[model samples]
Target: MTKRVVHYINQFYAGIGGEEKADTKPFKEDGPKGPGLGLNGPLEDAEIVGTVVCGDSYFNENIDTALPEVLEMIKSYEPDLVIAGPAFNAGRYGMAAGAVASEVITELGIPAVTGMYEENPGKEMYSKTAYIVPTGNSAASMRKAIPAISGLVNKILAGEDVTPDKDGYFPRHRQNYQAEERGSLRAVNMLIKKLNGEEFTTEYPMPEFDNVDPAPALKDLKNATIALVTSGGVVPEGNPDHIESSSASKFGAYNIEGVKNFKDGYESAHGGYDTTYADEDADRVLPLDILREKEEAGEIGKVYNTFFTTVGNGTAVASARQYGEEIANQLKEDGVDAVILTST
Candidate 1:
């Protein structure tokens, strides 16, 4: 059976108007045309059964709408694989390709692939989610990226096992079933050989995560009263609360009547990093001194004294949550509203 593959492209590559038509919503075409020929030519066992073209603007602006509609159209064909542009240097186009490929793979569980230049920002964003081949920064590299993806798609359609090295695509930490057996015993022997100054290659490799998500901004600061909390330990001298140094289950609160900030006697017992600086001025980590300054400046309504603490670095999530709840209960009793938690 000929492998049926669906191709996705932007308006510019679809031979439609360029930037002016970048707002085009998705539409289906009968078969390969223009750039689609590149994919069809290399994929001898595969045929471009359908094509989806959308304006870059429409894809980026109305992704929720465009993706579902485009997916609905592609679903009618029931292709074995979905392929999108390895969008070279085009920023918007690269992003569109990544977005569409990720959506199709996630929604349909169909094999998906795309190509992008090494320096292309899209590679950083979506390479792990889909099979993205390395390409040049110009249209000149299309020939290379297209054929690479096509070859991989053909193998996938044939139900053949493909690996990161053999398929020539960026890995997204996805695990595949290994047909050949060589469990732990074999692996240990191979390791022993390597330790004996013999060259050896391990079939399995560790995966990488090149993507990161920035922390979300604090919500509702205008009308909400904010509190201060930290992983820094600024408990009362002589360790009155007896809070555990690292995986603390309890939190402490000190009376800041005449205390401008934590003195030399107050210290952090966290085992993660050097807490020397923070110990000298506990406010450096908790920033109660700054909050007090802000309060004196009328920047905030109130400064909740004696911020919460726990050693974040090796602390179990369950312990952290329990400690948090305890401190939160105290804050509630003291009429504390919101919290500014500083993590190390």
Candidate 2:
């Protein structure tokens, strides 16, 4: 019998709209929409019985409500396997895909698979819970992603043991028994190769490190301007920018000129922590009040009028680095001599 597959995709893939329509609720389509069409031939012996489309923002933002509703939809189809997006590196989309696949596997007791970029926050969070095939950083890799995911799905449906290296999925760090040269002998061989300056691959590779030299201390704090930056997600109440609560795609800049404290109309958008205190007094997270007091006492020259904020929870390093560079450039242009960055 042919295996039945239930496919999930986001609004963008469903031809609804991009970020603007990202709050669309979950809905179902017949079979093979968007990338699902490409998955058809590759998914041998399996047919995409239905396609479930959802908005990335909606799924991540309303996970508790959306997940069960989506699961019920998938369950109605009675699929043998559930396939979520090859979400690439889109943080929200990847997270949604990972979450859907996980729910299908755990709640519905069905096999599920999803795909994403290696560095996508979703891969780190859900790889162990669902089979996640690695794709490139964008949907431009859809062609490659579909085939890899479909091939893995075939293996999984066939009851074949699919290993990460062999199946192009992210490693879940599952230990497997393998016959190989003894560890001591392997170590000696590696050492011999190193001593002889011969090419050798270590069984374990050391992680690369990013080294940053610290800047010299401010020569005159009384005359140097300082700015505030934070990944704590503190923002004016109602969040004008719609900055995501998790896996934030954009950073916000707010004017604090002549402002003494974060009183009413200020709160945290970060979804990872308790918002009670931050909501009551956002100054606890950004500390603009304390900085202002210091400036008044001549402990610092001045506080820059603008502060940068973004949610750090589950945000991709690449996105963070981009935000950092942009924020730094803005600060430099404003003649800010130093910055205080906070996180939550």
Candidate 3:
């Protein structure tokens, strides 16, 4: 079956005015318009079923508000896949393409792809979320970029295996498997050959992260004794671990064993927000003071004295999980009761 593909572009590509039309809201159109024609013409099993255009600023400033509406538009079409820009280097356009592509892929369970220059900020922001082809810095490369995007769309719609070099695009961390055996031994031999200046193909390519199921809600928070966890790097004064404010090295658990109040002396190093609340009183974040108050008031069971803290920004998902697991194990061992984690 030919895949029903939808294309996303900014107002300019949709035949709307220049910067003036950048704020175009999504509306269903009967067929391709503007560059949508290029995509619709060559894509074989795919048709440009819908075009979603929004101002770059609109998407960035109003993402929370815009996403639902955009999603609602996409749902009406029921496209088999979604495609967005060969955005070149237009900053806002690149970001809009990536953001829309990622949301459709995740929220709607549809495959989405985008194209942008290596320098575009969106490349870094949404590269992990969807297919991002390396594009020329401007529309001069449109002919080349569109064909590349078209080829990848063909492969995706047909469920064919694709590679970075063969597809003429940067790797999106998507992995593919081959039938023939080329175990680590053969793979290292190939790598050694490449190192010695011989031609070789890598055996295992880094695959994009499979869609992650949202973290399951804490089970039985009221009865099962839920513990609070955050990567928001809420920590005590001086950051004893010297953990960087954004890129944390290791999480630390502050011992509030005998401390009565988080007043006067403590501080937070978390850089996401004004650390004042977390800093002026670490208790505001760890809420140890409040938790203790609650425990004393019989509002809850015993308050766990030591709570875990770590930097949330730029922290890898893997590192966060490891911290949680370690802290959870410790909590189980110490017989500390439920936890209430506060984020900064």
Candidate 4:
């Protein structure tokens, strides 16, 4: 039996436009468009019955409204499977693809698959919820991405058991039952190998932590200009930058020139933690008040007028790294000698 499939893609892949058209609304077409063209050849018995196109920004910005609509469209097609982008490393596009694939699986009870770079924020957000095939960081990888994704989709539709290592998808971390000796025996063998200085693989591997060398102590605290940076999601009242409560895509730089304390108008946008205390006095998270007190006491030099903030909850390491680099550059340009970075 021929399996029906629905493909989802953003505006850029639909031949509409690039970032400029990122606000385009959701729409549907008869079949295969953009990368879908490559996907069709490798899809085998799975036929793409329809293609849904949406702008990355529009889908994410209006996810509440967009998801139901997109899901309804896919549902109407009654596809046996749904496939979303090999989104690469484009943050918004990757997010949209992951979201759509997840929703289709959960809400529609249909098997769905998407592809993205390992570091894409969407991979972190939805890898466990959906099958995300690994892809290169840009559309230049489309040729490679399509084949892998299509093959996976075919396997999924056929009810074949898929493993991350063998299938090229991100690990969902689902435990697999295996017939083997007890853990104690395995540990004893590993210890023996370690004592003999022989290479051995452990059944469970510990994650390596990144260690940062501490910077030298400030030589002149009373003269150094200090700056405040936070991942606590503090923003002026309205959250003008629209920074997301989770998986933040950007950071905001706010001027605190003569502000003595963060009050009612300042609140936390972080969704990972309770906002009660942080909202009442954002200084609890950013510590602008303490810094001010230290400045008044001459314990430290002036505080930089501007501070950088973003929600760190579930934020991708890549995005956080980019924000850090950009923030550091701006602080250096503004003559900040040191920074007090706070996080929830």
Q: Which candidate gets the maximum lDDT versus the true structure?
A: 2
> Could you give candidate 1's per-residue lDDT for residues 148-181 as a string of tens digits?
8888887888788988777778776767676465
What range of 10 consecutive residues in model 1 has the weakest lDDT sum? Answer: 310-319
Clashing pairs in 4: none
In candidate 2, which residue ranges exceed 4 Å CA deviation? 178-185, 194-209
* Tens digit per residue, CA lDDT, model 2, 71-163: 988888999999998888889888899989988888888889998888789988898889998898888888888888899999998889988
| lDDT of each candidate versus the true structure | 0.73, 0.89, 0.71, 0.88
Better of 1 and 4 by TM-score: 4
Tens digits of per-residue lDDT for model 4, 167-208: 989877768687488888989999999999999987776656
Once superposed on the true structure, which residue ranges of model 1 sit more than 4 Å away at CA? Answer: 174-344
Model 1 gets an lDDT of 0.73
* TM-scores for all predictions: 0.52, 0.92, 0.54, 0.82
Best by TM-score: 2
Model 3 lDDT-worst window of ten: 219-228
What's the CA error at residue 222 for candidate 3, in Å? 66
Q: How should the candidates be ordered by lDDT, best one leading?
A: 2, 4, 1, 3
Q: What lDDT score is found at residue 215 in candidate 1?
A: 48
Please write out the lDDT profile of model 3 over residues 1-344, one tens digit for every residue.
76787777777777777755555666656567777788888898678877776765466546678777777877778898888887887666776788888898889998888888876767778888788888887899999888888888889888888776787666666566674655867877887998899987765656476475655565443334334455666656677876545434478877666776666556776655777566666666655566566656666655556667787654444456667788878988976445555566
- CA-only RMSD, every prediction: 17.0, 2.1, 14.3, 3.4
The collision pairs in model 3 are 22-55, 173-207, 173-208, 174-207, 174-208, 175-207, 231-312, 233-310, 268-279
